[model samples]
Target: MEQEKMNLKLDMDVQKLETKKLRKGKHKAEEDLKSLKTDYKKLRLSMRTVGLGKTLEQWCQEIQEEKIKVGRWERKFQAAQMQNRSLENSLSESQNERDELKARVAELEKTVHQYRNRNSVVELKASFGRIEQMKRTVEELEMALQNCEAKIEYLEANDDHQSEQLHYFQDQVTKRDHIMGEAVV
Candidate 1:
């Protein structure tokens, strides 16, 4: 009975040592699970940060491109403004030239009208002078014709009287010749 009691006490001590070892192993496994969970969370946070950084870079690049386009458009606008100003100046010069030409044309028209009026007055005066000369010539020709008619009438009357005297002389001569011839016979 003494040997059996000693063996029973040794068995009890071995059971206590096994219980302590089991508890230590369980605590180690729980610590390992927690470390794995922490590592997963860190990985998720790093992935999100990398994705946001790429998005920000893309936005910055778009903004830079837009700025470049705006600069190019501004230069084009300035050039167009300069061209418009030059065209306006050219238009003004053309208008001034047109106005001057109009004034010159009006002056020339006025001069032409004055010359036409003077020419008409000179022609009227010349026509009046010609009419007066024609009247004087007609009067002189009529008086000369009357003098010639009077001289012709006088010459015809004198010739008729001379012819009557010549016929009387010839009859007297013929009667004398007849009386002489009778005496001779």
Candidate 2:
């Protein structure tokens, strides 16, 4: 009878230890669940803040919109570049004409110098009239050259403005690319 009582007491102690271990395991699992819930919430909030929570369809739509904008900018840049080339060509042509006029004027002045050395009065009078005519032509050429220079200056200014606009558009493209990269990541 005493041996049976001792066995019963030992069984009770074993059951109590098992119950305690089970209770500790349950508590640990609850704590782990709470931690997971908090971490999940934080992750969701971060995703929203970083713009990563957008749907795949939304991202695709945005990317398409950006592509359209980029295409428009590229077209504008090409047009501006073409205009710039044209302006450069015009300036080159104007310079060539100016140079030709200068050469012509120099030749006329040399002819006048030769005429001035001649001894005939009639020849001198005729040469003087021709000289006046040449001078008027030279003045007109000078005026035309001045006009060409003004046009060149205006074209250069316009080219500068177009270059600035190109840079601005390029910066916008870079910004869009960065945004797209972030979205993809």
Candidate 3:
């Protein structure tokens, strides 16, 4: 962006220099034409009285042609000045556009940064919720496993008590049979 501004300034400076050079050349041409006209009038008077084609006449004709060419250059210079003005206007417009684009880019960057910050916050919140939910589920599962283990312990104790009762009844029946056999003898 800085480079673009520098380039624009350089372009303006060069354009100004070109315009100044053209104006200076136009002024010089006008002065040369005035000088030529004065010399031509004097030379024509001398040629008329002397009755001869002098080197001065040829030089005067060349000066007249130079004056006509100078007029054309002056007109061309005016056209160039107009073009320079148009270019300056265009450059200014382009600079404005560049500034606006920079502002838009900055705004977009800010928006993206804000969105990322918000998204990260949301993700953290979701992760925390999930972790808390998992902790609760783990605790519930542990309690259920403890309850199942307690039931298994109770069932094992009941089975042992029932087996001991069955053994006691069998011993009593065997003793009664022995007593009855002795009485019969």
**What TM-score does structure 2 among the candidates reach?**
0.50
lDDT of each: 0.60, 0.76, 0.63
Best by TM-score: 2
Write the number of the candidate with greater lDDT, choosing between 2 and 3.
Answer: 2
Give the Å shift of residue 75 in candidate 1.
1.5
lDDT of 2 by residue, 1-185 (tens): 98999999999999999999999999999999999999999998788767676799988997898779677767766776676677667667766776776677677667767777776678767767776776676677667667766766776677678668767877987897678657756
TM-score, each model? 0.33, 0.50, 0.33
Worst 10-residue stretch by lDDT in candidate 2? 86-95
lDDT of 1 by residue, 42-146 (tens): 987776554433466775885687568556655655555555555555555555655565565556556556656778767555555554554454455445445
TM-score of 3: 0.33
Query: lDDT of candidate 2?
Result: 0.76
Q: What's the candidate order when arranged by decreasing TM-score?
A: 2, 3, 1
Q: Give lDDT: candidate 3, residue 159.
A: 46
Clashing pairs in 1: none
Residue 128's lDDT in candidate 2: 71
